[model samples]
Target: MAADPVVSVDAVSKVFATRAGPVHALRDVSFSVPRGHTLGLVGESGSGKSTIARLVLGLERPTTGAVRFESVDLSAAGRAARKRMRRRMQMVFQDPYSSLLPHLTVLSNVVEPLRLHGIGTVAQRRERATQMLVRVGIGAASAGFYPRQFSGGQQQRIAIARALVLEPEFLVCDEPTSSLDVSVQAQILGLLQGLQRDLGLTCLFVSHNLAVIERMATEVVVMCGGRVVESASTEELFAHPAHPYTRRLLAAVLPLEGDAPPLPADDWDPASLDDDEREVVRISPGHYLRA
Candidate 1:
């Protein structure tokens, strides 16, 4: 049998009440993240990728349905339980400059998580934090420098160090390399892959870049307009995209031989779709596509 999932989002729906109207950010979205596996969530801007990330992190509660970490429902958890759960799961944001403390040195920022969780003694935390920095390619000597002193890539390295310092079992990365240069993007991706392998971490990697997702993800979920249009193992999804939206997304990113694949002019209209009907269909044992 397959191992139980470390993270599970079960028929989750999220609606945000904006002044304009009620915005449905997620619609019965459900997926389980197997331990030691990376699940890539790919979609364009305003596609609700970040909303799902927030729900998984327990930073935001779903309007309906459940978000579970280690089989514990976040929405139902008490404050103390939730706090303990949050420590096992960490997040790495796209903008490391904004995420890291501007006033604190890299060393202090990295050790902050450990200190908050009361993971180790001051000496042990410093040593572990320094080691994490070194693992991310930042030397101990540079740890004293502030965020502004380091380059964009270095700042991200520090952020990654901070996230990993606590030895988190799960990681939620929201476009973590999007802000970096092409060269630096590759470096960060490589570092993340290496760290995941070394630590046996389960990850939810959210990105708009299909190429990045293709490289980092073992399995992929393709979202469009707050719904999952397709989900499959990385190789299968790239080779055969079952949903129209997923195909359009692939065509936009992957190059074709002679001419570009023609996409439907009609934008995804939620009003046209029937919520009562099955929106997603199983194409194979493990692969699913929007019906």
Candidate 2:
């Protein structure tokens, strides 16, 4: 039998009231993340991908439906309950520069979560923080330095250490490597993969980079207009993308190499497509198509 999902999102939707009217951010979006697996949520800007992450973290509430963790409804939980649940789930943000506090030492940043959760005594927290830093490839000696003392890659390593210091079961990585150099990105991804293997952690990786998603995700979900347009294993999605929108996205990033030619300007027009062709469609098993 399939293992039970660590997270279950059911018919979730979100709408924001704007001066013009209500903006529907997510519509009947639903998916589940099984224990110890990574799911990549991919989409362009304004595609509601980040919104889903925010909703999962309880930064915003859905207009409809529910979000559950291990069969417990987070959407319906009280503040104290949600706070408690947060210990099991953590987020690693996109920009390492802004994520870490400039004034705080690396050790303090990593131990803050533990302190907030009242995990242990000061000495214990310090020991755990040092160990976590080592796990992320940052030496314990670097723990006394401030965020400004580190390079972009090292700062990100510190951020990862902070996120994992609590030993969370699930991690929401919101474009964590997007702001780094190509080499640093690869290093960070490798570090994350190693940590996941060592800890058996589940991950919700959100990114616009198809190549990055392909490398990190066991399964992938493509989002558009705040809803899932396609969902499939990384291999299957790349081998045979069924959604027209998904195809267009792939085409935009096509050639996938330095030597490939760009698409013709005329072929980029969106107004020329039919409504169904523009919409996302559910296709083969474990795969959905948009148009």
- The clash numbers for all candidates, in the given order, read 0, 5
**Alpha-carbon runs more than 4 Å astray in model 1:** 254-277
lDDT of 1 by residue, 131-185 (tens): 9999999999988989999999999999999998988899999999999998999
Show the lowest summed lDDT stretch of 10 residues, model 2.
268-277
Taking the tens digit of each residue's C-alpha lDDT, what string does model 2 give over 1-291?
026888877889899999999888887888888888899999888888999998888788889998888888887899999998899899999998799988899999999999999999999999999999998989988899999999999999999999999889999999999999999999999999999999999999999977789889988888876777788888898887766556667766645567445333334433233122344456776776654
Question: Number of the top candidate by TM-score?
Answer: 1
CA lDDT, every model vs. true structure: 0.88, 0.85
Q: Model 2, residue 264: displacement in angstroms?
A: 9.7
